[model samples]
Target: MINLSIEEVLKYERGEVCNEEDCKQMTLERSQSNIFMAVVLRENNKLIGHIYFNQTVPFEFLTWEIGYIFNQRYYGNGYATEASRRVLQYGFEELKAHRIIAMCNPENASSWRLLERLLMRKEGQPIWHNANQYAILADEWQRNNE
Candidate 1:
């Protein structure tokens, strides 16, 4: 529900926000999706990080692919993981998303680790994107109490 400035979004796009451009494109695509959100972190009102998702059909079933990024200065602080966990809860428990997935470059050990920490199963190998390919899918998320 946070308002992210276009400048802030662009900063992410240019890789100043995260070391990865896939992270930036995810933010841009989320802004376009309208169904998605880019939650930003602020300190003294300065934008510092973001988390977002998009609905995609990587399998026969509809699913939402979640993504996130935190400023390099903010790394090791658990911001990205915490935000991702909350967003996954929102997507599953509130939005009623049938499945949620996240893709990351195989070299992005931190991101892959985050997904694993969330208990998202590695669904498959790399898939193509913007002239590059990477690991895809986590799994369908099921809210136990539901």
Candidate 2:
């Protein structure tokens, strides 16, 4: 996997690049906010990706939206699925979340399939970000796991 190009990684993921200061500020903001939490996905002690969860909106403590990205090289080895499953458990059990949701670019078939495989039901119409939304209730997660 490519190593150490912050601008390139940001451009690839967010369609924009940031300078070092902006990156540091963003990290600081996330760190200061108790509402957002992130977990790293690693393989053999190397970082492969990140999975993040945060309240869908401030004051909506029982609901969360999850987002993730992985290096292109690790795209099809089931790392996303494994990491997401564990994160979903953390959301429901540790965070006491009642619902967990996710969204992806409408054309991202792999992500849609991954969400479905995790048992999240597709919901609502597509939004302005051109993303399709999917969600799973805590009860649903529990029943399925049991």
By lDDT, the best candidate is 2
Model 1, span 92-111: residue lDDT tens: 77767777877666656777
Q: Using TM-score as the measure, which candidate wins?
A: 2
Query: lDDT score of model 2?
Result: 0.74
Per-candidate TM equals 0.61, 0.75
User: RMSD for each model, in Å, please?
Assistant: 7.0, 3.7
lDDT of 2 by residue, 32-129 (tens): 77644444455456656666777776546588888776656677889889989988998899988999999876677778889999999889767576
* Model 2 TM-score on a 0 to 1 scale: 0.75
Report the Cα lDDT for candidate 1. Answer: 0.60
Worst 10-residue stretch by lDDT in candidate 2?
1-10
